[model samples]
Target: MALVVKYIVDGYHDLMDNKSDPRVNDWFLMSSPFYTLGICLGYVYIVKVLGPKFMESRKPFELKTLLIFYNLFQVIFSSWLFYESCVAGWLTHYSYRCQPVDYSRTPLAMRMVRGCWWYYISKFTEFLDTFFFVLRKKYDHVSTLHVIHHGVMPMSVWFGVKFTPGGHSTFFGFLNTFVHIIMYSYYLLAALGPRYQRYLWWKKYLTAIQMVQFILVMVHAFQLLFIDCNYPKAFVWWIGMHAVMFYFLFSNFYKETYNRNQARKEAKAAAAKAAALNGKPQNGVHQNGVEKNGSQKIGICFTSQTALYEHSSNTNGVKSVTNGYTSEETKTLRNRAFVPNGN
Candidate 1:
């Protein structure tokens, strides 16, 4: 155990010593991967293990006010991140196709580099999303996909900050932060409850927006391979691969949550309609087993003919119109009928 710790410490220092970008060397959590990995693992241990175990005998915490503030903070923070990214990457001397990381000490270049670090740090802050869920004991919300996404993002972004802080690749950060601004704003509104429900219908579209972001990132990254520029090919490939993975994940989620459920609902509605149409009271004059003119109170039921017509009047034995059973053959056919209860 001592040797393992020594090895890790030595490796962390060696990695830090190799850095060429002096601008990012002193930034928080940039010296080594260990700090970020430790925090991420600690987060997992708390939310997945310790937090749930502690809450076993207790009721879930509401954390309503905390969530509201947290989400609002995210909205503002992401807006700032996005704005900085745009001003640095788009408004400055950036080549959208194949911009390389700027190691210069110029003001615009430094702003872009700072924006990259901010985006990386933002991934750490997003862990609070899962933390809030754990505090609230919303275990079902802490899905495997959610964990993978949040867990992998910081480490990935860390490399972005450490290696290629600002380039064509940083565009991913810009697009992503833009999406998060909208996303966290939605979350903030949703946390406020019923008054915001009307505006929250677009909540379902959040996944769609995320999938679109991944698609855009993939497009932007793949364009690097076709052109000749200074941006690292390795980072471009990494970005493209990550984008595809996220796209697949989000698309699968969208299909399962929206498409399959919608299809099932439509199938159910069609079955109900078919059943209702077949049970129309003989002359097609009834609506949902009740007479259009409100004369009778027939209900759509599937029961034996004897049970249906036993209570009806057979004064002239001319067949019963009330229960829709005409003759012995029709009555014994065991077909669907509109039988009123206690009529």
Candidate 2:
């Protein structure tokens, strides 16, 4: 294992040592529209075609022993990366000061020799994000935002390691590592059970942390872009695009999550009022089971059909985001049960 890591470390050092500006790499990746297009299209194919097939093969969302083991492995993987990053940072503080450190002659001079390989390897491991989602069969949750974020982050890190392996490299990985601490832990609990759902109320805030990470990445790149930080410009811009896209995508996410959702609920209320003359269109299932009041999955009458979605995990499951209803409102709707005698 140490020998494998040494070769990988040597590989990283040979490439990143000469890098003068991070933005050069950044532009190369961003300039090629195909890079972004290919990943997106690939995920699209996965979602539209492969996604259904994958879901069909597995049971939807059961916390079996395999998932338990996966979660445990995730903890180990993320924790190792986090520790390795700290070790790399400590070495980088000395190696890049005033003069660059030469690693060809001496092996120890390489920043946490094996740590860099761990860093690179962890990038590919992140692809498991989507695979697990597919395994768990949370199809509706697998939106474009989910796919792109999962797919791009790992590749971005791969390029970052390929171009610049140490020094300010620690900066990007550290923030991400810290976030992963919370993120992976959340996933661990989420995999275990819905009892952990309340703890996940701040899932949106995780995106907020991602936004902060990108902003900091931009700042790191800007320093290298202007002043005498010896990262690569091509590399800086290459990774910087990730930051910018993350900001725009996540900002839009926040609005869609918090702001746009409210506007939609208001619009829904107004439309509901206009249609209320026929009957107060309280959001609920009608007698015929077609969602007369609200277009929900379950019906007004709790027949055998309602049992499919009533457990709250099926088609008639929680519709909190789309129609822009809050958790509170969703709860109210679920409890009311849409009887014709009631509003």
Candidate 3:
């Protein structure tokens, strides 16, 4: 046990002393990995455990105003990061194919180092994405993928800032920052209220954009394998593998969320059409074999399978359903059921 402990300590010292970027060695949360790790672990504990327990007895907080500002702030912050990344390397001098880290004290190199450090800090700020969900008691939105993605980012970026602050690998951060600008803009609009929901139809495309980003990162990182580059191979594998992992994860989410929703819509349409052809009511047979009347029960049986429908009667003696929900409540329920939980 003592030997193992000593070996681990020695390795830690070696990496910190000899392998890390000297320019960023004294920065906040950069001197050691434990600081970042502790914050991430605390985030997991709160979101998965303490946070839920705390909200169990309380009514969910309606942070409408707060959310608007938070999302707007994120949009602005992300835009700045993307611009800095571009000016530091991607736009000015960094080669897309095989750019290596500039460890010198030159102005451009220092600017990249500063950009990488701010990017690391930005990951911690994103913990609020999950925190807001927990506070609002949107537990279903806090999925395993969401938690893992948020929990791992800071620690992953810490290494980037610690070792290779700039280079081909920073391309991932560059792309990611750009994606956030779009993503947070969506969230900001959503927080404004139901009136803005009509403008938010392209939510599914956000996931597609994220998936594309991972693919781009993978291509940029893996190309180094075929060509000779001065960059470290370890970082190449690390960044490339992370991109591959996240790409598949986002792909699965897209299929489950959007594709499944589309399939349900098609099935519902076919069922409605078949019922219309047979001149029978659209509702399914009751337990005692009675036919349901009116659109009140229409789509109830089909949409109930997905638990996405709500039935309500209007003052007029007529009944109607719209897009798997009542016409009166579609706006509210759509946002609740369909909005991506910052994944």
Q: In the order shown, what is each candidate's alpha-carbon RMSD?
A: 7.9, 14.9, 12.3
The C-alpha stretches of model 1 lying farther than 4 A from their native spots are 1-15, 278-343
Q: Write the per-residue lDDT of candidate 3 for residues 227-278, one digit (tens) a residue.
A: 9999999999999999998899899999999999999999999988887777
Off by over 4 Å in 3: 284-343
Q: Sort all candidates by lDDT, best to worst.
A: 3, 1, 2
lDDT against true structure, model 3? 0.86
Q: Residue 195, candidate 3: how far off, in angstroms?
A: 1.5
All models: lDDT? 0.80, 0.60, 0.86
Higher-ranked by lDDT: 2 or 3: 3
Counted clashes in each candidate structure: 0, 22, 0
lDDT of 1 by residue, 207-287 (tens): 999999999999999997888988778889999999999899888888988999999999978866876677754344444
Tens-digit per-residue lDDT, 128-147, candidate 2: 56666676776666767777
Give TM-scores for every candidate, taking all chains together and pairing residue i with residue i: 0.77, 0.61, 0.82
